[model samples]
Target: MRTRGTGDACATYNQFSLGADYAVSKRTDFYLVAAYQHASGDQRDTNADGTNGGLGEATASIGSYGNQSNTNSQVIVALGIRHRF
Candidate 1:
């Protein structure tokens, strides 16, 4: 699942993921995965602006923060596994 939001001058995006594994044999296994996402409004760096002057800078973009721009996306994949245990 995914979500998105927007505010006066802010926008946000988020994502969540879940995975599960299954055993097909004593030395073989398979896996499955699922994902969800949510988005929040844009974040203003109250500190970065030299206004708040807090420890870390405020969030100018929504979603999570930094590299992950307010507008972000997520994906998940599953694969097979082999073990001797």
Candidate 2:
């Protein structure tokens, strides 16, 4: 899909994600999750004053959140544990 942000440029991306969960007990669980994204099209360049500077290639920022990557593709992986009372 196409998306717009702070400027006139538009960007397109394809993302894939996977997640798994394992229950160790009635009160505990283990989980793992991962995501990959590739961005294309053009993006706006912003100046220090928040003005549109120019247009450039779009970079990947997984889940549309977190820090923007320097390249066109990005990967994210996370593992954790959860417990209940």
Name the best candidate (by lDDT). 2
Reference-based TM-score, model 2: 0.80
The TM-score, computed over Cα atoms with residue i paired to residue i, of candidate 1 is: 0.40
* Per-model TM-score on C-alpha atoms: 0.40, 0.80
lDDT of 1 by residue, 1-85 (tens): 3344444434444556677888888787878776544445444445545774323212323233334333334343546575775
What C-alpha RMSD separates each model from the true structure?
Answer: 7.0, 2.9
The top-ranked prediction according to TM-score is 2
Q: In candidate 2, residue 44 scores what lDDT? A: 82
Cα error, candidate 2, residue 46 (Å): 2.6
Segments in model 1 whose C-alpha atoms lie over 4 Å from true places: 1-16, 44-70
